[model samples]
Target: MVTLQLRQLTVPPGHRVILHNINWQEFEAILTELGDHRATRLAYSQGTLEMRMPLPKHEVAKVIIGDLVKILLEELEIDSESFGSTTFKREDMNFGVEPDDSFYIQNHAQMIGKERIDLKVDPPPDLVIEVDVTSKTQLDAYEALQVPELWRYEAGKLQINVFQDDKYVESDISPNFPNLPIIEAIPTFVEQSRTIGRSAALRAFRNWVRDTKNI
Candidate 1:
């Protein structure tokens, strides 16, 4: 993790000071005050005071994951009404963090009162996906959110972590949807720049499903 440096500069008696050191806590407080502003997507972290922003790679990966989830919902006949990116916040331990993608299923979708949500609510999303483009480890974030399941796509593979007994356990495959071929083909998706639009990938997945049923 990189630490931001704040410097103080002295000026002549008659001149105005060019720079001054600002306390990290005070900086975070200013960000909190601007929470109502719609233009602000992310604020500084309370602990590190690090300014966070969504990257382009994050957006691309999110689109692919969202599309896959939509396809899965249709194939599995699951009732899902909403899907969104890292625009909502989850409050835990006096800090709020957002995941890359989140979705509500079944009756949980009925609780949404508007097109956007900013506050924490009961029963988080059924699934949360994160595109780990940053070097910072996500273990702490996962622990804080207390979400039931999380999927991370990083270094050409998909890692599924299921929350159990206040901790996350990793597995080679997703337990939430056992039949999905997300894990098997994630490497190919990561390798090809235009992989998401490849018809062969979907055809391969369909073949895998058929083979599983015949066995």
Candidate 2:
């Protein structure tokens, strides 16, 4: 027989505690316990446990938004780091959730550590991307982290939300990259990706840029 020990995690107000210190067997057991609940999902770290609930479908629009951001990053001259399906944890609530894609700009992008990020002090990603495939759990995760900027992509459109004045507000432009034409370029990228290979897409983008510049 295998046994698992549970430890309470101290989190700040408005955050929930995550249980820590369990083996794989224990982790599986917990999920089994919560089977078919549809209200919560459990995430396990090396020695930690994080519990989160589902969010509404509209809340996961960041996935498509992230794909758009990645393509833009490759085209622009800026130095940045982008991640797909990466996990971030907030110490205040012991909450751990994975973003569809997350990014950091310029020097801030280099600050990421090699192993695990210590979310207690490190600033959250400049942007969080989520795709509403099925559940609302993504929204619950973001709310717990109190991250600043989140872009959700759903129903074939993108919505940009920024955390300002202690709340989230929709914006016409992204706070992270004000120069990029997000709305104008996103749909084009999405449409192109569906019909052509990646190299072809790049060539088309180059042509579009040259034509727009009258070069």
Candidate 3:
């Protein structure tokens, strides 16, 4: 039987606590005990574990970015399978992580109608969104998982990370949105949501997409 004799540290919103020397069994047990409740996110890499609870700002960024991505996919007629904060893990690599939001685009057809995702069997998500409100995302963990693309939002700015040469390098454009300027477009619309309203902002965004893409 696996026993998790780990210390429980309660961190304030937007903050995280990291514990060292955690084994895979203990990490699995912790995840099982936590279950599907999403108030907190857990990440494990090698022998380290991190727990984070999203703040209101963090939540806002997540929703805005996720919604914009969905809009882009819809207008472009791109099929996607979203797994929001679903834990992606591989025991062999000793890595496990849950992005704020994740999606399967190029490989969406491969995961159709599936309830569970096994990283060992299925391809990793094509795009992962990270809202870095207080703590930095664990890039090493995602590297171990070999995620193709990552969008990290911090301080009202978006940074695109593309996997290349065994590392994630910051890029100005996304492979999925080669023509769209996502870095600038997303933040502008997200700010509009704050000034006008979500519905109004979304309406404007849709209009822009339709006019720009002739959709």
Error of 3 at 79 (Å): 0.8
- TM-score against truth, every candidate: 0.65, 0.62, 0.94
lDDT of 1: 0.56
**Residue 92, candidate 1: how far off, in angstroms?**
6.0
Order of the predicted models by TM-score, top scorer first: 3, 1, 2
Across residues 60-145, which tens digit of lDDT does each residue of candidate 2 receive?
Answer: 23443454566566555556766555567654464566666777664365565544466776666777776544433345456566
**Rank list by lDDT:** 3, 2, 1
Candidate 2 lDDT trough over 10 residues, lowest sum: 6-15
49-165 in candidate 1: lDDT tens per residue?
Answer: 333444566566667766666656656667775545444434334344456677676445564665655445555566777776643435555566666778888866788888888
Locate the minimum summed-lDDT window of 10 residues in model 1: 10-19
Number of the top candidate by lDDT? Answer: 3
Model 2 reaches what TM-score against the true structure? 0.62
RMSD of every candidate to native, in Å, equals: 8.5, 9.1, 2.5
Which candidate has the top score in TM-score? Answer: 3
